[model samples]
Target: MRGFAQLLSGFLLEYVPRRRSLSENTAKSYRDSFAILLRWLADGRGIAPDDVRIEDLSRENVESFCLWLSDVRGVCAATVNVRLCALRSFASYVSFTEPAYLEWASALRAVEFSKSPSGEVEWLPVEAVNLIMESASSDAREHAMLGLLYDSGARVSEIANARRCDLRLDAPATIRLSGKGRKVRIVPLCDQVAGMASAYLAATAGAPDSPLFVNRSGKAIGRAGITYVLKKHVAAAHEADPLVVPPTTHPHALRHSKAVHLVEADVNIIYIRDFMGHSSVKTTEIYAKISSKSRQKAVEKAAANLIMGSAYGEEDKSAIMEWLRNLL
Candidate 1:
């Protein structure tokens, strides 16, 4: 029997990171999923991770592990699905490499993922966004960071990984974002954000290789650090404007605000998808559904009778008659 430990190590160390070239954060998440699975197997089946064989990974055991993640560990459906995905991916690798484990791998692959709820994206109101921007203007780093976040709509990890060389701050300024799966997309920066970023970069004496946003120690800021900066300004904005600003908002809220604002501004959905580095247009359509103008238009189309009924005879008589003709 093939040692599960060796296979697991090779999968994580060789395949995921080296072969697939996934980010360290993603690799860590996959590693953690397997760790939880191993712990469950030990507790439930008296199988140590190192001692477990390929034959132990039956469909029943895999289903039980997923159930334990939800029922015993109290993890959400999304988390369970993530674990299932990892297991399926590993099973696929095993099926290709070791023909003897093909049946077990097929069983693992047959396991279905749990259905997870799709939560609505939370975005800040325009007034609240204005207030936050105004407050951040007092601090150069915060101003630049927040401006870039709103203008580029980059993910937190992408923003954190941003280098000074990625910025094209001259005319028609743009920044290249390193997206998931090693994909790169260039997002244009608004003039206002470009100006802020230029000034902040100058003030910090940043070089082409230096991180765009760094802590006082001159190290690149992590996700937590960026979140702290956002939280600080959110608190200030909330205190300054209690009615407009939301009391609880995060960095991603700024990204969501940018997407919603773009949809409200009558920007094309395709352009927004490219700007936001979304893999699918379906992801970009969420912003359209959330836009107040889009919702208002839908409402008006639905309730046209209230406005048109009063002047139906004079204004829309020809169209109404045409519709009546068609119905008759």
Candidate 2:
């Protein structure tokens, strides 16, 4: 007989953080999902959010919410699936805590995840990445940020959350990145990037605990801010050469580009997985697949060009076939 508000508070404040040990970002995403759902119920079903009860979270209403998200809000399938997952997790939590709602939870869990397309991963070529870096070369802070972003292959959040103490500019320089699930990994930096980090740090000395990257206002740059910095450089690179930098270049593309480059260099898949902070090698295999496909296309194109350019006719083909048969 617990109210919806009471259950949601416990699920988000305690169960998600304490029991599940999820990160703040994940908790916030879940909270936003519920907020959207509650607003939908209030506006559509005329159910006041505060007056809503556990019984109001019926399977039909949950399914309708998914539809409304797609049709009205214009959200993508992946986003819809994330919202569904949040509700499913909340229902599961309720089932465990309040046995009386076990049936309700079961019904809610029956809701299917929205089907989402597995689109091709977008990445930039090495030349394009270098061009983007060159565009930011005039600004020391931007150059250092771009260097760490690509060399470390860290997500925007990981780079944004980095502290001054996380950097090591000594021999075999590396930076510590905190990834999802609060996992920390040390990623080595190339000599060029290491030097950039050293120079940038020396120019702007701060407390060891202070953020490694900060805005002009002396505040720690958030993920959006990092994206803005990247886009600004990307625009400059695009103006220099329209073909080099795509208009849609974003921060995650740098991470993907690093992974793709590693795959092309014949780096072991397991090593790439760990380097990219991927949870499994299966996730890392996508880069290998992309590289393989690119090679296949190149070989096919070369074979086609050779055949078309050659003067070989039926007589030339017969002679080649006879020579092959004799050798066999």
Candidate 3:
């Protein structure tokens, strides 16, 4: 048990941050997974977290843990799979540090990830996005933040972590976003968004190193705070027209909207991939597929309207057919 505690500590504290060089968000996710697992074990088997032995992490227990996450906690398959991934990573670490648990690690690895359905990516249409932006016009910070989010296609964390020094408001304005794995990508800002950002910056002057967006208390805005800001404006937009924004709209929807708009503009897939900071073009391809579907729907609607609205009688149709034959 002491061995398990020490190794677990080292894996979470040292290996994850230093050796793996995972981002802070990922490290926190792993920590939360383990925390839930420990609490579950403590409740079910009456074993305190410190008293948990390495042997307790049998394949059966891990499977049951996943089931508990799904059935008891009402979490989805994707979330369960995330917890399983954390466990598998820890198991690999155990296998390397202590060869005696090699078989145990192998058993844990054998646990399968739960299959999750591929759901449609939720995104706002341009009109809806414009409505939401307009709804937040009263607040400069909210307006600028929404504009930046839609313009940059950055993950919420990247926006939350943005600093004043990262913005370049000169011609060809751009903002530097640090994404997963601490990779930095510079995304260009549109002139309208750039203007909004300029207004925001002038209103709230701070050190270059200070957070670009701050909460009312002058501290750096976190992911939750960002989400709150988005939701507040979404609610205002909803009041104007309930159909314009989904009730559960999140910040990621803006990112998706930006990608889909880029696809509609006939942007190159490679450029869109880099713009979205996606590691693979395959990730960007989803937007292309979405765009194709949207276009097909529009075309189908237009075709249906043209056919249904036409006032051609049987005689007129026959005349048109005869004309077509003659032309051919």
Q: Choose the strongest candidate by TM-score.
A: 3
lDDT of 3 by residue, 1-328 (tens): 2388998999999988889876676687789899999999999878899799988888999999999999998776656876887898899999998988999999999998776445868787897798899988888999999899999999999999999999999999999999999999999999999999999999988999999999989999998998998998877774344334444478998999999999999999999999999999999999999888777656554444446657886677666655644532
Query: lDDT by residue for model 2 over 1-328, one digit each (tens)?
Result: 6778888999999988888876676677788899999999999999998889888889999999999999998775656876887888899999998999989999999998776445757787888799888988888899999999999999999999999999999989999999999999999999999988988998897999999999889989998998998999887775454434454467988999999999998899999999999999999999998787666655654444546566787687566655644532
Please state the error at residue 65 of candidate 3 in Å: 37
TM-score of 1: 0.55
CA shift of 35, model 2, Å: 53
Question: Which regions of candidate 1 deviate over 4 angstroms?
Answer: 1-118, 292-294, 297-328
Per-residue error (Å), model 2, residue 140: 0.6
- Using TM-score as the measure, name the better of candidate 1 and candidate 2: 2
lDDT of 3: 0.85
Pairs in steric clash, model 1: none
**Per-residue error at 20 for model 3, in Å?**
56
